[model samples]
Target chain A: MSVLVFAETTGGGIAETSLETVAFARGLDAEVDAVVVGELPHGAAGELAEHGVRTVHHATGDAFGAYSGAAWATAVQAAAGQSRVVLAPGTPRGLEVLAHLAARLDVAMAANVVSVVPDDELVVTRQVLGGSVLEEMQLPDTPALLAVAGHAVEAAPAPAPAVGTVRELTPEVAPADLVARVVSVEPVEAVDSSGLTTASVVVGAGRGAGGPDGFGAVSELAELLGGALGVSRVVTSLGWRPHHEQIGQTGSRISPDLYIPCGISGAIQHWAGCASSKTILAINTDPEAPMVTKATYAVIGDMHEIVPAINEELRRRRG
Target chain B: MTDVLVCIKRVPDVGGEVTLTADGQGVDARHVGFTVSEHENCAVELAVQVAAATGGRATVLTLGPAEAVEQLRSALAVGCDDAVLIEVCEPGSYGPADVAREIAAVVADRGDELVLLGNDAADTGDFQVGIRLAHLLGRPVVNGVRTVAVTDGVLVARGDGVDGVETYELPLPAVATVLEGGVEPRYPSLKGRMKAKKAPIDTRAPRSAPAGSGRVRLLLPPAQPSTVDVLGEGPQAAAAVVDLLERMGVAR
Candidate 1:
């Protein structure tokens, strides 16, 4: 009758993906209860309460400091006894913990679920074949475990309920559970974003950019339109860009309002990551490029010349 | 002396054309043959390389059906000193956690100083097994590992992150998930393959209690709608097609 979500946190705060999971659980029509396993940071509990979480269970221990699959699985198993469905984000920790919990509870678990609905059975739709395909699934059993894919759900801000409660559960773990400790935490520098996920415009590159130097022109065009820079797996493989900036199957997926792909052949894996963009413009010299077929607008010209011209036009329009 | 366990999976080649099953919950194995997964092979190779460098023995461990011995033979052919197949469950019956538990039980039974696995399996593309195994064993884990070298009483490794490669030095008995391009995986020679066929392989059921991971309803990808638009040949025709695309607002 209720949904128990394992809210993931880093540096004692809820992660953006966890909030997205919270938003998804609201659509399941189940009472949402969040389980936080460590010390709640200031105002963190308040944020969860605002999202219609009625109960927050805080399980505290030195064993819970770092991500321990067994410890988290034990906590989730204990929590699942009271809930109908247990949910977590399809992040590394989320998938790991849920995998263990599913085994411990002797229940089935589905990973990277895009959508779930209650019916005769728990009907779920998930991506398969590296996002090239969508598969619909039905899990009729009780206490179903599901890990929702990251970025698949949008975090919707909801008003806090009048009342919510927090309680603590002490997990039973051995000394070995404390063996793996996080010695330190380093935060990555945050970049100013026109919100890559929600941005109205995006510019993506691929191996066709030639290398890191080629990214200069793509970056310039992105800046002109106040958009974000994206790339294919090849760019990441070549080490020309960081993995976070890669916009393919193995990297951060985006669904911007307008997507402009330059000097890129649209592979199935890459298209799976960006197919959700509202409008697609492809600029490739290869007239038969796969991306050209998918694009709402196609420019059969040299990207080196076309991209710069577009950038100049946007700059002039801005000025 | 140090004990090393390398966990590997026998996965179908993902790059090949695949056929769907009649039920759509599994892959058709008729045309699909198994190979040591790209990353898992690297993990096994790394363990063998380290053992050869450090004067230790490398044991390859896997959990799958009886036919998975093909993968073990492949590992042994590559230079693994020994092999163990934990026949606890079939492939796809368990998720990463179940796999982690089985691996942990095997590790505990065998007593290993280090553990290694691929970053993700090729079939499911779930990259959490190595990390989860470490968490289950209560050991430190490093993901996306590139280079690994043994130091005095410790192991030093470099891993790729969201940013650049990160180097970490940890004591023995850590888990590492090998990444692509970490090292070129060596192919098994004819002599090595012959020796592997004669090699002794230890097979047993894992001792851990079963964790009932839920079942997933697997289905094949939808058929793509055919929209084959073959443009006419010649550069002039290509230019005309460009103009047509521009008129359609596809190109600017």
Candidate 2:
């Protein structure tokens, strides 16, 4: 049986995550095909060919102009005629559409899966509780529906490129399926700090920052370090930080090279988001806090005083 | 008047290391406290607000063990007018699909036009039930929503999409999985607590059989070996931190 992957697009090109997902599908030991909804992204066919995708199903029309989970699922379902296994990127839209597709097909789907071995029963390894735990799962039924987690596999080209023949289809979508279509889109608000998930270094603040006014030192440190600012769940819940900057289970998961969390009592939820970081330096007055104990480096002190000192030291070293 | 049904789950408040049970089927909850997830807290808050503004009934539901009544009562204390618990033998063992089916069976006839749930359960992180339930009930769904309100029979749900803040308007009989940070979940007052203590919980058994999601085991990730080097104490540690940063190639 063939494998079908939903190719998600961004900025007129295929998303990096979708390429990674295509690489993931190639490892499934099956002929890989792709389905792209909306306008076919530029250079998408050539890119899929390099990734060993044999067929590219392009589903586009007036009905596909807007983002509708149900309508998108219908297109994906229509395209997934012969493929028993379907995969999508573990992104918000990908997961949403897969959930809708799983329901429409009346099948069980696994989300954020890192590994899968197809057989009579599909064996999969998936991250749960925000990557802190790995669960080995089995899909008992046919047509194993899965959402591949972000960055689970490296994006690579095949040894030999495939034909990448493009096929077009007009999916019959009912008006009822477009019931939840997007009405409007408000542009993203400008934030002072860079994107947390894409940053190389992240400076995190938590309850130990004292209060909203206490973020001055840590904010300055983040700027001086040329890094983004991140905060723990409590910071957002307390309104000290915005939701986008919160690095925790209910927030963004980051995998930066260096992470310095100040005054954060590393709860499991918070750890789940930042655990993927390569190096962690925790600053907390309580040495026994989880953040301190689990960190590669720990400083036993108040962040209010320690952070500014670190900034001063950074400046001196730069001079 | 619109009726709002908020579904919640009782998850262990995992503050530290998550320990699995002897069977590896569930989390070892003996040491940790219990509470709903952050997203669920906001869902409960939104439900209470919608019910209050519309002069409608707000009901809390859960397909969990008998102890989940605690979560139900907590929602009641926060202004939910009613509670329903579909008691199960093992709540953790139920997959997202099974949970959705059970919920669909429970609320299908309740005439609840709006349903709210956490974007994903705190423990399982399935992120499937809300959308699945919507499809099962033939209602429209929107997940990862931060703000939602029903006005003149249309449910306006706004969420952070991949590109920007997405707004979706669905007709009555809809589902939304809420993410935290939109609204502040209020604390229960003394009077609300008293009423919740006396609230009547309608408990029942699940109608559908558990269709396993094929989960064989839950394994904690191998711990990263970390020996935290102490960088002195107070501001005295700053120089040492910068030195280390220099060594790590982060400091110029």
Candidate 3:
């Protein structure tokens, strides 16, 4: 059985998550081929070959320029003619495309899958409620559609790289598929200089930050640490922070190396997003809070006092 | 005028602890209350606004046990003009495809032009229903949409993407999965609650056979062993924290 992987492109190159999905597909005990909907950067095919992809189906046209879930799914379906299982990155575009394909083919599709045991009956472990719970599921049908969650597997090249053969495939897209294509894009006003998902250090604020004005010290500390500012769902709902900056289930999932949550009680929903962090430092008045108990280091005190002191200490050390 | 339909699901409030059922097929809700997800709340609010602006009817629908009517009633209290309950006998057994197929049948029958759903199910985290329903109905769909507006028979949906704010415009009869924080959801007024108390809910049984995701069991992830070191207390702990940060190489 051959596994078909969808390689989502970024800046003309393959996305890192897509590469991770390819790595996951390589472990499936099936011959893996990949398909790219848009233009592939020169020499990127070698990267896929390094990851053990045997064939690269390149589908490029003006119709594929803009992203439409339906159109991309059409291209992927046309390229998945011989594969028994289809895999894609757990990114938004990847899930959207696979859902469309599953609907068109009248099959079940699983999203955010973390583990897959490939047998005649495929058993997979997937995240539910934003990783707070794990559900073991079986994909009993052929050509099973699965989206591999981010960081499900590490992306690495094989010991011996195989030569990747590029084959052109044309998508038989209908006019209806292009209806939801992107019409325009504009840069969003940044709440912080760095993105929360990619930041090495993240400073999170919560209800204990008091209110909208309470974030001043927290913001300063984040700036001093050169980290992004994230918030609890309560903070967002209270209109203290934008929805994009909320870190939890139904929000952006972050895996920073150092996550310092100030004045936030670590609820299960919020924990789902940051459980992958390497180290957690929780600052709260209540030492019995879930975050404080789960943190690598806990400061049982008021953040209003502790944060400014930390900022001052950092400035002194820098001097 | 375009009629708006908002799809919602009843899930555990999840404010406190989350536990699994004895069989592991569903969440154990004995310790918690139930409500729709935050994004679905925003979807209902947006639906009500769009329907009012277009002089159209705003309808809320769900596929769950009879108790899910509470969610529909809440939406009605906030100005939804209609309610639909496609009562499912085995609530958790209806997978994304089954829910979409059943919802598509209702949409086709009602001739609702615009459909809205939460970006994903809060309980199962399934992201396929909106996209699947769109495909089944042969309509354009956009997910993760935070804001939407209808003008001149075109639907303008905007959402935040990795790089920036992305906008998509589709003709009428489109679908959008909403993310919360786009608009403020209003509280139910006393009069609205009285209205909702008397409102008639259109309830029916599932017309299609069950085709659920083959869920074997639910399991909680192994807890990370945490040993918290008390890094001093009060403002005096700043020096120690700075030292730890410096030792970790995150701060100089």
Candidate 4:
């Protein structure tokens, strides 16, 4: 019952990935502990306690700078203390911290873990080759670091005992290790739009949206659905959409409740990004298009006609 | 002059339908064509460009069977000065940890000021190697670098962050994982290909494989039972589309 989870604080609260990570650790049948960097939001400890975290650990130090992978990993590793496993979400920051932790622990760290089995050996199934393949890694029977894939599971509360006790500890850091502190991270100014990653409904457009002006109906349907718009790599490459809107191996990976990809052939790269959706609805004229074959629903028609028709149906129902 | 080393892998292009081996230990690459991923190809291109400007030699390295020589040759064709193949008899035998170990040894001996790799290998798909190698060598590393350059006495690596381009400046002797963005990898010219064919490539085995081999198996993910319900067609079937949406609980 010894597992430590990094509950990454975001916007002064725990991130969804942190909660999902807590849920994942609980599933391992371990005494889950959490590391809260800043002040926990109101009722957050109770929320974590609800999910089997008995002890909340935080490091007290004014010296640790803002969001550097070096300081953060050192701080978390101090709390990790002899835990059989340490896990975090596979975000850029999380992976960086976990990598440093692995080097310190001298244990193999596995990323993009889909599932873990506590067999005779610690067996981990991970998404490899940009989610094109799944490989099983058998680790040494010892402490391990694992970064779970995004949206691998939903966050649900664990069986409650009590709200966890908060503990203050200090991490010993080598001055040299903190040399490369992240000065600042700024987001590029993006157009006003729904983000592709967290959107519940993602309507993806591909090259088959026809020409640059072919997305009118698709945009109308998206507005009606009140969802985000995603695009395939070809759409971005052709300058029809920005690269930030691309959903593929080299772009944003999304896992919406429902993904409706229009005029997309569903190449392997595009499929890798969106394959985690709860449901997929593909609209393509080609019956043999890979996207159509792999979708939950397929509309074999021009997207110009199908999208407008879908919009019309919604409008009629609303009326 | 700062020597630049770029680590590249030859992967079975996962373009169309993918198949697994009979034993399910690896991708069924027998029939599939092989090529360096765009990510790695761009890294090699960057190394060559950077080395040319700084008067450094660019070395391309890979850990795979002798067949990977073809890939090494491609890197040479595109302007890399030399190549190294850490030949392993069994493919997929060396995981990320092992690859990092072998590369780290070579870097220690060669003393390259800069090392570049694809953010993640297209086949193994692990992002740990660059960071792992950096940790071992006591050097700074920035992953997912879309652009890297030497400016103002420091190496500034810029990658797309959540916001704007996240920039990091490090002293010489650093590692970076390159992503494809600004640089489109160029094809090898006929003269360059001829030069690459005769380029000298060093072949060696890892001094000693690191401990704790963790790979148990490689297999394809279980196929989901696909039921693609045809939700009508064209504009006339809007009625059916509405019905289908309502059934899925998305449309009210």
Best by lDDT: 3
Task: Report how far off residue A227 is in candidate 1 (Å).
Answer: 4.1
The residue pairs that clash in candidate 4, if any, are A187-B163, A187-B164, A188-B163, A188-B164
DockQ of 4: 0.55
Among all windows of ten consecutive residues in candidate 3 chain B, which has the lowest summed lDDT? Answer: B12-21
lDDT of 4 at A108: 87
Query: What does candidate 1 score on TM?
Result: 0.74
Order the numbered candidates by lDDT, best leading.
Answer: 3, 2, 4, 1
Q: Is candidate 2 or candidate 3 better by DockQ?
A: 3
True contacts kept of each: 0.12, 0.82, 0.87, 0.61
- lDDT at A164 for candidate 2? 93
Tens-digit lDDT string for candidate 1 (B53-160): 888899998988888999999999999999999875557666666788789888877778789888677666656677667766767666667667777758777754
Candidate 3 residue-wise lDDT, A1-20, digit = tens: 89999997777677888989
Docking class of 2: medium
Q: What does candidate 2's lDDT look like per residue over A122-176, in tens digits?
A: 8899998777788999887667889998878978998889999999999989988
Predicted complex 4: CAPRI docking category: medium
Q: Best by TM-score, which number?
A: 3
Number of the candidate with higher TM-score, 3 or 4: 3
iRMSD of prediction 4:
2.5
Measured with C-alpha atoms, the lDDT of residue A276 in candidate 3 is 72
Candidates in order, TM-scores: namely 0.74, 0.95, 0.96, 0.92
> Which whole-number lDDT from 0 to 100 does residue B69 have in model 1?
94
